[model samples]
Target: MKLVAGNMLWTNINKIPNQYNYLNESITCDVLVIGGGISGAIAAYYLTKSGVNTVLVDKNIIGYGSTSGSTSILQYEIDTDLHGLISMIGEKKGVKSFELCKEAVYDIEKIINDLEDDCDFSLTECFYYATKASMVSSLKKEFDARKKHGFHVEFLDKKDAQKRFSFPVEGGIYSKFGAAQIDPYRFTHALIAKAVKNKLKVYENTEITNIYPKEEHVLLETKNHFNIQAKKVIIATGYEGRKYIKEKIVHLLRTFTLVTKPVKNFNGWFHQCIIRDNNDPYTYLRITGDKRIIIGGEDEKVGGINSKMSNLSNDDLVSNKKYELLLNRLKSYFPEIKDIAPEYQFSGLFGVTKDGLPYIGEYKDFPNCYFSLGYGANGILYSILGGQLLRDSILGKDRPELELFRFNR
Candidate 1:
């Protein structure tokens, strides 16, 4: 299924062409990871570092999937509010999820520093601004809940928020920590390079058609009729794995993004902060190092396993409409933008679970098969944490966060 049609951030940075064809014969590995996005790459990296025989495969190049479409805003705040999260899962579990997200942010920072990647990694202050008075109280409640959970957050009134941020806003909550931004494509490519250097085998342009569980190994069938045998398998194919795990709670939502030409004197409104609002189908904005504005939003549920559709395509008009709407919103909010028309426009799909919590851990009844999905726009941070969690699980290490995001309860 094609969620995004045109070239995106991932495609723009993927200049080096490398393709791994389908497996021609049976192959074995200690651990096999499916999908070559940030999650799979990081998972392979960690596993290989632990001396595990790991193999990573993807139908296309690394970052060719949803990773290319990501806006790359790394923030601890989730799309769902803290209070809402508490309502979905118990307060204790909700708080645990919140802490896991915060840790994920730190994990990314440490990874970038260790890898010495030149990706545009920057520490950003994230804000959830209130557009209407009704949302003001809700935002305040979230602020209080977050603080109660030991997070560093401050409530900013309208005047204070306006003074701090260049953008026109009424009030908001500011978190000085657990927020960051990066060029996801570059980060993913760098991680793949590191993984390769660590002796992790990766296969691109090869799609896995079926997976069968055997006595002591799992058999993976590629579209080219090649077979792979591995002791364990990881399904990190994003929304593509909804078919294998029949959970209706997860919804595949389509979102569009556009990057405009760098605005002169656009010293950036939030400085390092990834800006967003507290609104349904929320909108997020951030300025790149080159001074171009990157805006993303307009989420609509298209199709997944529950839908009647058999195949998905990116050539839909709905995606184009959403792209235009996003551009118009950007122009309206920031009139200083020279040209509202974006230099590039693209759409990508993300899976959102009903509880707004990612599902990570072993699949039910599949002893050696694991799955991580429904991370939404927070895939980068979660991918980092998920990789470590998967690695620890394989190494028989204790990871407390696993209880909060395990699949099938």
Candidate 2:
């Protein structure tokens, strides 16, 4: 599908850092990754690190898909709140899910450090506040849950919250750990580049037209009519890979975002940390390393219904009114930032799973094939975990946590 549209902030800011050749000839590998976005790059990197013969391919230019359009806000918190998630699943698994993502955040830092390229990665605090007074009790319960789970967090009431932000907050959770940000486009390219040095093959503009799963291996055919045979395949194509599965796991949605012009001051944006509120369809804001504001929210389901949404493919269904509303919301939050205007406005297609956890494991029908779909707001972080889990799964390691995000679950 058309993963994203409009002037993407990341790709527009970063020079097209790297490029890969399209698959011109048939090839074979131990593992074939069917996507070259951030998730596929990450999964390939992990496989290559383990000395597995891996090849990654994408139908579009690498990192030019949803990766470029991503706001790239990294956090341990699931899109579902802590208390809410605990209520959905059991407390243990829910907490572990968040912890896995927390570990993924550091795993990302370690990857960047090993590459010796920052990719504009940074560690930052995150604030989640309640918009109306009615939400304070629930917000407090969320804060307490985090605190009880040994997370470094502090509860802030309306008085303390107002002291920090330009907007009002009836209550908030200020987390001191496991939050970060990055230029996802740059990071995706960096991972592929490094993996190439370690003998990982990457091909862009290579479309997989058909998949033939055998008892021993799977064969994939590119649109160019070349055949790629592999012992295993990893579908990291985000929501697009749903073509291979019959079960419904996620709903497709488009999120609106805009990056503001650089400002000399943030007004009351405390620490310029990542900020989000308790608004129904929450809005998120964070300061880039370059001093611009990256804010996004106002998600709308594609086709506005489940049955119709499944038919979406490369649909140019972006809304101009959503962008305008998002821009106005940013201004409402920080009205004092003079001359502030969105230099870039964009929308991206994403999938949100019921429990806000990525699907990372083997499927029965797609035997010898695995899915590492990081379908949530914490896409990059989940991708990191997907890489590790898929690698271990391939290596015959037992991971019980996989059940939490199992296809059957």
What lDDT would each prediction earn against the true structure? 0.78, 0.87
The residue ranges of model 2 lying beyond 4 angstroms of the native Cα positions read 304-318
**Worst 10-residue lDDT window, candidate 1:** 305-314
TM-score of each: 0.92, 0.95
Candidate with best TM-score? 2
- Per residue, candidate 2 scores C-alpha lDDT tens digits across 1-409 of 4567777788888888777889999999999999999999999999998999999999989988778888899999999988889999989988999899899899999999877468989999999998899989988899889888888999999899878888878899998899999988889988998899889988989999999999899999999999999999999988787777888888888787888888788887888899988886889999888899988888877754453332332223445677778888888888778767878888778788888888888888889999998998899998998899889999999588888878978
Question: Model 1 over residues 364-404: C-alpha lDDT tens digits?
Answer: 76768888664766777778777888889888885888887
**Maximum-lDDT candidate:** 2
CA RMSD (A), model 1? 2.4
Could you tell me how far off, in angstroms, the CA of residue 38 lies in candidate 1 after the best superposition?
Answer: 1.3
Q: Please give the lDDT score at residue 395 for candidate 2.
A: 90
Q: Residue 399 CA error for candidate 1 (Å)?
A: 2.5
Worst 10 residues of 2 by lDDT: 307-316
